[model samples]
Target chain A: MKQAVEELRRQAAGLLKEERVKCVIGWTQGTDVARAVPFFATSVRQAARLTWTPFCVNNLSKYLLNHRYDNTPLAVVVKGCDSRGINRLVQDRQFVRERVVVLGLPCGGMLDREKVLRVVDPGAALQEVEDRGSEYMLRTDKGEYGFEKREALLSKCLECEHNIPVVSDLMIGPQVPSPAGSGIDRFAGVRELETRDPAVRSTFWDRHFARCLRCYACRNVCPACNCKECSFEQAVPGWQQGACWLSKRNHPGQNYLFHLIRMFHVAGRCIDCGECARVCPVNIPLRELYRKVMKDAEELFAMKTPGTDPEEVPLLSTYRTDDPEEFS
Target chain B: MLVSRLLEYVGLEPGRFEMRWISASEGGKVAETVREMTERIRKLGPNRKMRDER
Candidate 1:
């Protein structure tokens, strides 16, 4: 892991020094040990601060949208899951492949900060992290803490299928085995919800949606949500006579409409990066909602997972002669 | 079909939503489809799931 961090910094510095890219987006040490925040390195000195650890959880590809119109080339660091966001942007034609560099990392898994805090001191300063195949050994200024991968890894990581990035210009480190077991079912949660009665499911979703603050954190972090102008944002020129689709007042009906519309819009294009659920302040099980759409798409259209293949057309954008029309 | 499935997943009764194909020339078929959907929805009663009660 240390070697990978050193190599990451070296490559980032080289890219900046040679003027290969205007900036390199990576993670730097955050204020605490359990968090690694996104950092943009434009100079060699800034690149040296780049680091890699189990805490590097944010998907950096969405930041590419910021440079879309500038025409300035950029380099981005991606873990297995984050790499799909790049394919999503490129496939959407929102970004050009030639204008950016992809630095790939083979991720073992990322720690759930809340879970880690239970075992490690809140203020502990991390010195090093060692992956022991089954668990992570964290060396902190306070003490050493060992966390088993199954218990500490984020729920998304336990079922990850892309530990090694599908696309990359350069591989950063030796491949690490995926933490997901062979028989793990990624759609189990969605399936469970499907088996419930209609009223039960309604109550279940309402319990979560009612607490939503409508902050749009999920939309902002999503790479699949690459709209130039979101309908949720007010002051559009010609939408519903310039009125916002949903009122700013956070009513239950409006919230439900907000989530459902967003889900439908991203139905076939969602990369299943789990960023929505991760960033949700109210702890909504948003991945389950998105996966229900994915599962239905697969069962109905025999579609593959979105953003997995860069060359594949979006699910809803194209149709086949044999497409199911049972409802009609 | 996808929207119907999504609505069902979010707890709306399957009968509350429907889709049918009726060309412009098939005015009788359109009325028949609407009649069938209206009867099914009547049996299902009011859609109170996503309704704003406030």
Candidate 2:
């Protein structure tokens, strides 16, 4: 991992000197190993500051979402998951594909926060830690504790097959062989919940929806949610006019409905990066729902979102003369 | 927006399909909207089939 970090720094430094790219984006180790901060390099010196470790888990692609410029191309470092995000943005035509140079990196599943906490200092206080693969050694005054990587992997990482990136103009490291794990049926839980009566499903979601404070963090962080003017905020149509409960927008099921509709809208296009679930303050496993939609898109339509050819039509956009008639 | 764009991507000819904006309160009218769009699109034939081979 340390050697790879140095190699990444070298590549970034060289790219900065190329004069064609305006900036290179990658992750650097946070104050501790538990967090990975996004690093933007405008010069060779700044490239040295970039780093990578097991704790650098956040998807770096969202940084590219707000990136806008009239000139100067951007160079981005992407994992397999992050490349999927780039694909989504390209499909939407939000960014010109020719304007960006991608630096792809092979990924070993990132560490899960809760999993690490459980291992080191189960009840003890772990100030900081780093995953050294064999065991995660943690910083505690008493002494360092270590644990197996399996115990600390994020749910999404547990089943990741594309640890090696799918797309890149330049790739770093030997590509990883496909990941190993029992194939997860991401929709099984959703299906189980759906089997209950509609009333039961409604009851369950009401409790879930009630916890929503409407911070819009999930939407804001989602790469798929990029829109110059979102439908929810359009005043002319007033899609959810007076939608907030505290405000006078008295629309019922407004928040939940907004989320549901948005989910379906991005169904085949969602990359399942887990950003929505990770950033949600309310701890909703929103990725599971999106994953279910992703599974359905694959099984029913043979579509796999932004990972496929970017030119391929979005699933909902092209309807076959003979679409499945289960709903009909 | 998505459907129209998709048909275009697949090199399909323009059709009678219309994109409608329906509100949640107007849910009762959804069936009517779909029926109207279906009739118009069917009259246009399958949009993809109208395209020459890629």
Q: Pick the candidate with the highest TM-score.
A: 1
For every candidate, C-alpha RMSD to the true structure in Å: 1.7, 10.5
- Residue-wise C-alpha lDDT for candidate 2, range B1-54, written one tens digit per residue: 433322232223444435555778987678887887787777867632222221
TM match of model 1 to true structure: 0.96
Q: State in Å the error of residue A215, model 2.
A: 0.9
TM-score of chain B of each: 0.84, 0.49
Per-chain TM-score of chain A in candidate 1 equals 0.97
Position A133, candidate 2: lDDT: 39
Which candidate gets the maximum DockQ versus the true structure? 1
lDDT of 2 by residue, A1-328 (tens): 5556777889888888886687888887565335678889989999898876656666766777667546568888887777888788888877788888888877766777666655544445434454453455566665676655566667676667467776788887655543335666555665676466645655555666557666778888888888766665555534335442223132334555556666766767777778888899988767766766665667667776555466777776788976544322
Find the 10 residues in a row with the least total lDDT in model 2 chain A.
Answer: A243-252
lDDT of 1 by residue, A60-151 (tens): 99999998888999999999889988999999988799899999999999999999988888788888888888899999999999999999
Write down the worst ten-residue block by lDDT for model 1 chain A: A236-245
Question: TM-score for every candidate vs. truth?
Answer: 0.96, 0.75
| DockQ of predicted model 1 | 0.58
